[model samples]
Target: MVDFGTAEVTLEMVQASQIGMKALGAALAVGMTGIASAIAEQSIGSAAVGATAENRDVFGLALLLTVIPETIVIFGLVVALLILF
Candidate 1:
């Protein structure tokens, strides 16, 4: 068995670790939501394109549907901001 050296934990070290965790959390929140939004937009965009091609009248609705997934990214940004501040 290998022996591990003992290390003293200080208040500064604890605070630094907490800050790092907070930053990690904020990054995950934004990155995951952005990925999810991209996935959602992919399917919606394809369907929207098809619908718009079939009927020009549906273009407005299709546009709205395609854009709906973007809201998730905005929400992620808000969450990241909240986590950081």
Candidate 2:
């Protein structure tokens, strides 16, 4: 912006301001939770499946293993809330 003879600003300039790190915040939040879930599920699911495969009498073990991954989500939710608040 200028006086009466100011040159028009370009679209790139207009977009550059909003192109800051705001996007990274969401990406990191989501990425962390997603990674946590993936890691948890992989470990728990693999253990559960292995227990079930190793012994048909291991349903309790499998169940416990399956539920173990849930803790990650719970913990993540808590952390996310802490961060958000």
RMSD of each: 1.6, 6.7
User: Considering summed lDDT, which 10 consecutive residues are worst modelled in model 1?
Assistant: 1-10
lDDT of 2 by residue, 13-79 (tens): 8776545444445456657877887888887788788888989899897887777766766676666
- The digit string of per-residue lDDT tens for model 1 on 5-66 reads 69778899999999999999999999999999999999999999999899999999999988
Judging by lDDT against the true structure, name the best candidate: 1
TM-score of each: 0.89, 0.52
For model 1, the stretches where C-alpha displacement exceeds 4 angstroms are: 1-6
Candidate 1 global CA lDDT score: 0.92
List ranges where model 2 is wrong by over 4 Å: 1-27
Pairs in clash, predicted candidate 2: none
